[model samples]
Target: MHHEAFVTATFKNLKPNDVEFRMSRSSPGRYALHEFMKNVYDLKVTDGNGNALDVSRPDPYSWKVNHHDGTIKVSYILFGNMGDGTYSQIDETHAHLNMPATFMYMPNLQNQGIEVTFNVRDDLKWKVATQLKHVDGNTYYAKDLQYFMDSPTEISNYSVRSFDVDGQTINFVLHHNGTEAELDAYFEKVKKIVLQEQKVYGELPSYDYGTYTFLACYVLNASGDGMEHRNSTIITSTTSLANGGMDGNIGTVAHEFFHCWNVERIRPQSLEPFKFDQVNMSGELWFAEGFTSYFDDLSLCRAGLISQEAYIKGLIGTFNYVWNSPGRQFFNPIEMSYQAPFVDAARSVDPVNRVNTFVSYYSYGSMLGLALDLSLRENGLNLDDFMKMMWTRFGKHEQPYTVTDLHNTLNAYAGKDFGDYFFNHYIYKNEMPDMKRLLNNVGVSLTQDQNNVSFGATIVHGIISQNTIMGSSAYKAGLDNGDKIIKIGDTVINDSVDVNSIWNTYQPNDQVPIVFERFGKTQETTVVLQASNVYNLSLFETNNLALDKKKQKMRDAWLQTKK
Candidate 1:
């Protein structure tokens, strides 16, 4: 049987399943992005002998080609009785690809293959860029199936820029509507942070650690946020660029870029093989997203983008964000990532309840990461050493690392039962982390009081548990992780609620009555707030000012900074 391939993709005003196609084979294949385009994309084929062959929808997601002499009918159901919004083909103003037929892979009888590229429409609102080599006009080449699968070239009207950071080529793209200066500043600052991070690890990885940022402007309404990929990240927020905006997004960029070392390379076993068709579930997301979260602000501070005070403030922010959520009682980081599909879907339906049930792999993960680092320090090791060991053993690998790989490598690096230390808290336990104690060991104190019944515990939040402080008291109060604490006693809660709130209000010896809630469960507690032994963010500061400076010096050294 002679095998040949010819491919063409087009869109019409008609619904997706209405188009037609003629083929020389009994079956042809197709691939589509269901997330962006949802419809019954139908296809039919005929042989050269003028015979209509049997075509089965074995894989609805995959395209099929069939042998035929007559035209093969290929179409899909776009809009039903419900109107297809104004964003239809020809009628749409922007040049967004109606269908994601960007990369087509054709394999020979020998099991080898070639990738075919599509010429995306060039308009002012759109700019096309990809890792694929440009063959000529509208055509590009992918080295293999992997590249073809990963490459999504059409970044419609999203922010974009190209930069070279410390001889490492980098790209920064913002939402087109965002201010150019803002993006430029972010790129410059983050590049510096990446460079500083690399210096500590010794050598840099490959020069082509390509990075891109996509801002959705209004992600899922005003609920804009960001997520990371191997070489790119998607960030969206309502903060306009023209209004001198987007200070919050800076930490996000730092967090995502750092993933190049963690999840992208030095990853866990479950995450080694990415199952794009279904779920890429992992129990080690705490290590990936959590540690990345801890280091995100640290990287910024090390690069001098933020002051030490600001760095601690950032950590406090994470503490508050995580502690206020109520999901700790229902789920942990590992379980959350594993049940991501259901959890994410549930979030879309009932966001409040979702947070109550599901914990964030990133937030709790980072907390665990800090705990692990402190534990290592307690055991005579440090995070820097772990980072270097990870880089030397796993990160330098040409292929992806697995959970087993990460575990084995970490065990080898630490030379002990590090697994139990990590998995117990981050994966298995629904218990609160000893963040206050851990911070104290590192010379920072975490203190809290609601009423006469006062206690110190690591506080975190749940998705459905909104409105309150984050950390020990917040966690024990059965509150959601991202709760916004409104009022305490007679005072209204502002941006943050923690020991500092108590400090700013009542004197050290003053007894105060506190009222707070979890998922709107209002409770009252009376307790005497204690004067901090350590500075805020410092778990173990001295009773005097001079000793605090000495501890600060040590903290500076830990951050590899000049005192």
Candidate 2:
């Protein structure tokens, strides 16, 4: 029943005037504005002599302390009940601490070193797992505010597994309801993914503290999230490892670990020194996040954790999602990256159609990654080489990079003209690359499922919701997006009814009686079903003898694991 916790920060060497203390409006991995100060209350401030200080709150996120001595102590109580990689929670079981959501800092002293000490309850047995350098029994050290905020602390008596690679120790701290055997098996797959990702970059990045921690909280009540840090990551999920949830968990682990190089170290120029008070938007997240998405599944296939068929199925799913999204006609990958602050975990009380003009940077970027990889392969190069080059030029040196840096690297390796053309069409403009042609070169077939019939409307909530009528049969039948489909040929629509399966029984051009409810009025119409020209991409059967030698060589090279 412990729903609240207290935090006290003591500031020394203050300016002896008004100093502003603030909780972050947004966090690093989280693109949405959280307004963390909303959950904080009972703020108290005092001087070194224990005299109350004059505090003025200019805004909800900041508090201005006036009439303070050179040293001041500020304390507040925080209320948190939800647990994820981005939010903090304190309960009877454990304390999940996200620095940005739990700690308040002075904007002026952001570059100063910080030391944090935890006062563990004597009755509770909790162990600490974080990337922060340990000073002694209960204290930890961080070089700067950016480093401190990126580190998430998990104080729980969890099971731990350790492995070493390239002179660095990787620790997996798990607090979940899973057996030891299941945990060990999952760790083995994680090790393989780590090895494969390291191989792509040619080497692991220089860890700041010579250790990387995977702080995972897999509980039935926790929300799913995985946030990448400088030397570690926080992955929380409601799924149990003993069940069928390990595969999805592995995908998140691989994705965040890949970000250790892509977003954490490679560094977007706009987000280098992260802004806590405002949204930090970058145009290169197409590579920072999207390319990482591309490798998340590819690494699994390379690790032998998933089959080639399964991997291709995943790719086809992405292709279907991105290609079908209407936003592609209006926004490119770079534009979508810029839209992340508005769409990533965003919520709105009013209805505005985002489906018409919002493509996920993650999905679109992965599609671009696939297209570029195959395109580069046509020129005797691969995406792996490009990543390694970026690691050397920007990531290894810890230099902040921009879209221009990416273009320059691509031009240097794949020719100036080709790079210009690729960026112009795929990144600058809303033009998708020739996926069919690119995939064909690798012995894969990208085709559309023409046999599938649909009413040409995307339905939701067991009703024909907004944005449903997209020039399909439903649109032609005078049924708008807000028209709720109540019945189809006298068969009443309900939660159990599979709308697609119902339409599958009929063919294109077949007229069917449809009844819908719209704005408190019942309407009837006849909809002529149309073929859903959805892309269904798959690799050609490799087990047979009809495969071409050159195509087989290409596929082999594409799927080969680097050592």
Candidate 3:
């Protein structure tokens, strides 16, 4: 599968100086610098008279024209063969395009309008799905470069479904290997999620084009990603609906759809006017991305797509991961949000100490959202009300908000002193929230494994140590990262032997002989197995007769859909 894109732009008015045209270095939803200009080649520039214009190759990314008439015509052939939410791909099957990776823009004329025309093969029966307004047969119009770059187009012979909500159209464009029955069943769940999220904010923000398109590709050759736009979202995955069921793909849809209200409109001020050349970092992703993740699964439970027990298990898993991570001792939620440029889709060959020093803002922020929601519920206010207030103040107006704006809004809802204290401790300081206490307040029990014997560190593949919690048995015994465990208690450690089985043979405070390899040398040490203090939280049965009446009432209200 191979293809080429013939793109042309006409410059009407220009001064007698060098005009620069270049591809984007970074995209909106992606935090890393992707150097998209590397895939473009076969560039040619000419004046209106069809004479060759003098073009200069100043850098690897840009082309400069010095001697051009008032009208300049630039044409280029883009070679794209990979697909995701942030990159462009073209093949015999379809053409998946992310605009920043496909189009070239002048830095000076970024404020001007853009018109793009796609010349599709007549025999292929291809149709376009995007947020850009249609002008005619194959041409689309964008008011400015930002809007053009934010839109992604999918051209294929795919399955499409549409449903009306609040007098607006919600289109689901699917390109997958699946049956029509499976597709219909999957979309039913999607419709429920959309409606449930809308109930949280009390309403959906007005769409830019009176419609929202979910451009989804669940193909065998595609990578997984979900990126949000103004009126649409790009969702791609290697999992098929027929084989993996709706569970594999619906989470991404739930997350990206919620972003339409969170990050797309109630945006971080730093990311309001997205830059295509450099990484855009913001401190509010804990709310933007994190809070959305928290609600995505909750929305599933509320919509009856998932059971309440499944929801509680999911919450337990999230709480365990975030609370036990050693990175929490070093970075707060806001501090972790600043690490996106290095972690979010950014690649590196050399390994670093990310395990010991980094916790994903997604998980951390989700935990923060959960704790805050439960805490606020005890105070007679809920996160749903807080989100509605935010939507009313910022999202309704398409206003870009800052950290201060969030603090002010939260202060108004949850007292001035409490808001300041919450922000300082949870967002600014590297302190873990009291999840045990907070959960108990809502009639849930948070318990720890007190009698089980185990080394405290997380073992990767039963070989390498990843993160050893401070003062735990693993850290006290001098186990560190990159150390390979060769044997435990004279039993040779292998892939077949379960590590936990060996630990379970002994009780807490028992001495166990350990052998490990580090830095090309084998060493012997004595590990005293201790009871793990890390809270492995699980939701107690809500039907228990011993539960307090008031606390059960609080839990019931917390789980129900907000009016």
Query: Which candidate leads the pack in TM-score?
Result: 2
lDDT accuracy of residue 168 in candidate 2: 89
lDDT of 1: 0.50
Error of 2 at 511 (Å): 4.3
In candidate 1, which residue ranges exceed 4 Å CA deviation? Answer: 1-126, 154-167, 178-183, 207-225, 244-246, 320-326, 329-332, 345-353, 378-380, 402-404, 417-433, 452-550, 560-563
Cα lDDT of model 2 by residue, 1-563, tens digit: 56688999999999866888889998888777888888999989998988998888798889898777798898999988778977898887778899999999999999999999887654667888889999999899999999898899998778889999989888899988788888899899999999999999988988987889999989886789899999999999988987666887999999999999999988889897788998888898889999999999999988888987788888877898788777777677888898988887766798866767787888889999998999999888999999989999999999999999999999988999989999988888978878888887887888877777867676775676666535678878888777788889857888888887788788877889998898999989999888886787677774343558887788777886666
Predicted candidate 3, C-alpha RMSD: 2.1
User: What TM-score would each prediction reach against the true structure?
Assistant: 0.66, 0.96, 0.95
Q: Where does model 2 exceed 4 Å of error?
A: 458-462, 475-482, 489-497, 511-513, 525-528, 542-545
lDDT of 3 by residue, 495-554 (tens): 888887788788899998889998899998898888866565445664453567877788
Instruction: Sort the candidates on lDDT, descending order.
Output: 2, 3, 1
lDDT, candidate 2, at 334: 82
Query: How big is the positional error of residue 119 in model 2, measured in Å on the Cα after superposition?
Result: 2.0
User: For candidate 2, what is the lDDT?
Assistant: 0.86
